[model samples]
Target chain A: MLFGLLETGFVYFYWGNLLMILLGGGLIFLGIAKKMEPLLLIPIGFGIILVNLPLGGLMDYRYELTAQRSGVVQEIVIDETTRFAEGTAIVRTNAEILQSPVHGRLTSIEVQPGQNVGAGDVVAVIITTMQTDQSVIPTEPIGLLSRLFAYGIMWHILPPLIFLSLGALTNFAPMLANPRVMLLGAATQFGVYFAFFISLFFGFSFEEAASIGIIGGAEGPTTIFVTATLAPHIIGATAVACYSYMAMVPLILPPVINLLTTKKERQIYMKPKLRPVSKLEKILFPIVGAIIVILLVPSSAPLIGCFMVGNLFRECGVVDRLAETAQTSFVDILTIFITLTIGGTMAAENFITVSTLSILVIGVISFASAAAAGVLFAKFMNLFLKEKINPMIGAAGVSAVPMAARVVHVMGQKENKKNYLLMHAMGPNVAAAIGAAIAGGVFVGVLG
Target chain B: MSKEIATPMAGKVVSILVNEGDTIQEDDEILLLEAMKMETTVYATDGGKVKKINIKSGDRIEEDDIVMILE
Candidate 1:
């Protein structure tokens, strides 16, 4: 018995589990040492470690079982044999053979010898019995993280909250200063649809394709929100793909932007000053923007609504306290919980699959295509505009936020030292965020 | 009446674009405030000579707080 106990969890250890642990550790190292999305990656990495630990029971869940049937079997048949068969006589002989439908496993037989069992009686206690952990039987409760995860992510509360906090932190000046730049934002969404078609070609369902396509939006919250609602089974892989790609935007987008735009176009200087936005305009923007977007894509209302409301808190000039909370402490708390649960969801069984690999590849392609499309579209637009907007800013339209915009700024400076494109890039950068939200809403509305 | 230029929101004054006694035109930017990672330019409400300045670069101010007086 002691030997059996010693070998319990060890017998279940496999190469997959080891690899997952290493991947988790790698994420932790990346977060702490490399300082890549440390707020999210740290919790997520730790959660992954906790979940992958053998016999940790952090992921184990159990529930109560109630009896569904009361009467013992009156009929008996054994290989067409005409044995002593009818009434209580058969029941007496075959009572030991009875199986509880509620609990698939056999427990101590509830019915004692010559005892009558009634319906609704607790015939057998359904215990969580797993081969991985022979010691410490689980009680009748689901895992705490599992429950929080189900209620938080699966029920669709956390994503919008994250958006709300994001909105509180965002300043709409860039987008408002140059409204036409929104076209570049819309143009980048071509990556989403392009990847959608590609995923469909790979035999993914319309829902799955849509979920995968949103990765090109380059917004982690929107990607998670859409995937959790549509293709929930793949949330783990898709979210990782989204965030990993987002962090790699500086590396991924420049080549694509450079390849699409010539040195002349890259050197093109835009007027540095933006027309100052009025306080009234800033205050009205969130309210008006929300109404228009929600009306157009009701499915996107949750994320967009929260985002606009948070922006309202920032712009209204009356709710600085609320905006501060939303942007700082509240968001920090949500990020920890959300990332940890997201990481916990990626057990070896769920993450190490052909589908995960495919999603990762498609995610990168989606991001590349979005960046390329943005730059190409800008060049297309330059054909008509006299001012000749720099095409590099188009690459910022992929919603990787300031990172993509910064890449454009760096490229612009390299081409011409006098040129300052950070603010110019920001216009498309912020617009891309809205564009991605709209794309996500459309996908969910149509396919969800 | 001297026109008092006030900030529209709370933020750190990143720069004083104009100096006291400097001639300014209506809508000319007098100062820049950095808030929420975006810059807002505080413009002269009425074209006049700068009279008294209430805030300097790197000083924090609240909404409706007088930034400068123009005469």
Candidate 2:
């Protein structure tokens, strides 16, 4: 029986494939055991092994000998004419078309042979179905429900359940868009500057320091894009640090908030100003903000532009449809890709080091510092201001939007039942979004 | 119709501190509503004498139900 198997010529190649399998196994271990961004890294690591496996020419096109004539049958199976297994990642030799998940709307493509296309042009509108499944890379694309099976049972059920729970646990969205909440978020940003100096001690350049400092901001897209553009070499560590800290927000923020401000300060009663904002001011704010940001920091334009556009869409009375899309679907879709890419960039080799440990530490500290700075600034504002703004609401100045602000409101309401800080927090909350963007632009213009 | 202190959201009205025909100021707390784990005050948007209070402590209310009619 062994001799018969030896005659089939499978043993040598199978061993070779086994070694490749071992390589894949190593990647999985790195992603799973080491926790090096499992979502993207594990899939990519498995993909590497799966593509390399000599599965009797499954990945490629080939012909073989016929048993009747000499050996196995030789016929053209997969060829240039044959299309890719739908949804499988195939390198398009033709670089004319770009495939993008347009705001979660998946599109199908119809193509004829030998069509000329340019780089960065839309080839097809493929469905942007998110399947976090590693085992079924070669399988045809499935809808979200079916693909949920491709991933663990947890992946499908957890998201909606978690979102629902989160909606209930802490509805931070209102705070996210509010201005005072922004101040609180900004207060946490001193962490960025503090981290910047610390990274300098670790021998990072100014640009690298700025990239690392932003981890305190707890905004993933900003961190990833900044790191990718400024310090591509350290992108891996920076991203991992950013994400791990973001996940730890609940654990990280409270202790810092408590340590910075006393119970007496937290319990301070803030009389509601109840200032009703006119519709015209809301409309004018975004336009004026855009103009100011564009003039001051051209480099920051992209961040401010997208942000203001989203804000403008929300504020603009005429375009309810656009506003809804911007607030809900657009931001949500971008978030998935941004997180995946951020996770993907953190390779095991790049992430596991002393520098990464420092980045993570500093990142947490940066968030705390920003929160502190914001509260201090608010306290400072109280000295001269007649209204006697809540010092807690000042922390909302950071651009975490409604989350930081809502946290402030929650903390306030806990202290006194009548306090409603949500609306008051909105003023500084929106401002900080622009502030952070401008700061981002300044970093880019000076350093880039 | 007897004036009712209605619930804003579908939650227990844990406390109804006011009686019918009680003079209340605008922005004065009318009743205490517990919803989504937060105690919300149903304040009087307009100040008037509360007439014929229909809801007492622990009564439930729906959104936009007539809580009380000021006479």
Please identify model 2 stretches exceeding 4 Å from their true place.
A1-189, B1-71
TM-score for each of the candidates: 0.75, 0.56
lDDT of 2 by residue, B37-57 (tens): 446666665666788666667
lDDT of 1 by residue, A1-448 (tens): 8678644555445677688889889888988998877777888888877766645655544523333456553433221111111121112222343332221122233444445555555443332211111122223425656655667876789998999998998888878988989999999999999999999999898878998999999998899889877887688888888988887887898899878878898999876667788999999999999999999999999999999999999999888999999989999999988898888767676677788899999999999999999999999999999889999999999988877887787678678754567778888888888889999999989977
- Predictions' DockQ, in order: 0.04, 0.06
Task: Give the per-residue lDDT of model 2 (tens digit) for A116-222.
Answer: 43333333333222222233222333432223322312222222222222122222233433344444444545667788898898887887899898876655556
Interface RMSD of 1: 10.2
Best candidate, TM-score-wise? 1
The candidates score, on chain A by TM-score, as follows 0.83, 0.60
User: Model 1 residue A418 lDDT?
Assistant: 47
What candidate 1 gets wrong by more than 4 Å, as runs, is A1-9, A61-141, B1-71
Docking class of 1: incorrect
What Cα-based lDDT does every candidate model obtain? 0.77, 0.53
Candidate 2: lDDT of A215?
73
Error of 1 at A68 (Å): 14
Using alpha carbons, what is the TM-score of model 2? 0.56
